[model samples]
Target chain A: GSSRPMKQTKESPNVGDVMSRDVVTVFEDIPVEKAAKLIISGSFDHLPVVSRDGRLIGIITAWDISKAVASGKPSRIAEIMTRRVHSVRLDEPIELAARTLDTHSISALPVVDREHKVIGMITSNHLSRLLARRR
Target chain B: GSSRPMKQTKESPNVGDVMSRDVVTVFEDIPVEKAAKLIISGSFDHLPVVSRDGRLIGIITAWDISKAVASGKPSRIAEIMTRRVHSVRLDEPIELAARTLDTHSISALPVVDREHKVIGMITSNHLSRLLARRR
Candidate 1:
């Protein structure tokens, strides 16, 4: 009755190893239209919002930006960005990152450093890719 | 300084307590265009794909439908629906449901009953609302 494949017991991976390092970030003051263009053209659902010194501040998701555009409202990225961003650290377990994404119902998380500087991004798509590889 | 308000110590909530009972599902054989319209009109990013008997089967995200439409491919909902659906039972803890959504990187989960029938939907937006209430 054991039809399912045995779960792998290999060494657990960390967030740093699985995170995407070619990170794309947006400034807090950019026009919402510009951010929308970046997301549509790049096929990304979320972008980390950063400060002038590159510290992580907020995140903008497709839903927020698209709704604003669809509503034909003029706005700035800061107006639409979610300020209570949930993030993961470089040295944490990927499992924790996954839990964070789940608990918040968010698809991507900004990976931060000791000073809460943006380092990388880990998305549900990335986690899906990792699982696909394992299977 | 204890600036952060005392974390609410109330009894934890369950999936059934927060789920949207009026679920919107699409048949497996429908045209992808129809699905797109439903999403666009409703402002929903995901829909539960069900069998003719209303059995929970798969899921289709706006991303999948939009990409197929954008690529000018003639496709059916069945062709675009993800077959490996992750669902939660009605009686399961909301925390477990949150974890499932997180682990899978999905925004909503189709809540099922003992017979594996589609019952309700719990989404990240709902969770965010719940958290907002707590705060």
Candidate 2:
């Protein structure tokens, strides 16, 4: 049950159409230091956290990596990742995805399929670019 | 001149009063890889770029670090850091600081004084927390 008002659109675009397909991801058990390196070197603020079987398990952000590093204690990505992640389905409307970003105060969401495998990602940057182009 | 509207307030709190005193920062001369490590480990999305004297010169973001890493080329924080940084004065109202963050599409701003040295930092997280507490 979504709390925000839905933006009505005829033949609304699905997330699969709007999401960035070249998704960047991180492993669950990697050292926090290495994960931080991947995230930093990759220039991504957030990365989809994946299990060994390539299933979406959690989500991690630069903020999460920083906390782990700041702690000065060894840690793993899984420990720092946000386990209760908000994700959008491939078939979901674009407006719903946008609403999800706003409601959660997050920049991006990993798009998943029925098997919960990440297929792509949608982010505020993409949404803003889309809006800008329309104007 | 700021492109965004300047938020007005009476008896406004200066940034120095509200900003985080323990700001996480990076040196301009540091390797991009190291900067990424600092950003990720610190759980901070942005870090003020400082000169050897600890004077603010530029700023870097997690996105910048990730890009540098993804580029797979040798780079320094100075090369990737945004030299044209948006900073707030220590005496400026907190609303102005908030507006700056909103207009810039950035998560945080480094607070500077007359010497352009970073004295503190303000971020969206702090603003949200402040609002949450007031409610």
State the TM-score for model 2: 0.55
Fnat: each model in turn: 0.02, 0.09
Badly placed stretches (over 4 Å) of model 2 are A1-12, B1-44, B47-56, B63-81, B84-135
Model 1 residue B19 CA deviation in Å:
14
**lDDT (Cα, tens digit) per residue for candidate 1, span B1-135:** 233333332245678998889888999888776776666566657789988888989997755653453344456888868899999887876767666766766767899988888999877655544433432
Model 2 residue pairs with clashes: A40-B66, A41-B69, A41-B70, A42-B66, A43-B66, A43-B67, A66-B40, A66-B41, A66-B42, A66-B43
Worst 10 residues of 1 chain B by lDDT: B1-10
| Leading candidate by TM-score | 2
Under CAPRI classification, how is model 1 graded?
A: incorrect
In model 1, residue pairs whose N, Cα or C atoms come closer than 3 Å (at least 3 residues apart or on different chains), thus clashing, are A102-B102
List model 2 lDDT by residue over A106-131, tens digit each.
76789988888899997655554432
User: TM-score of the candidate numbered 1?
Assistant: 0.55
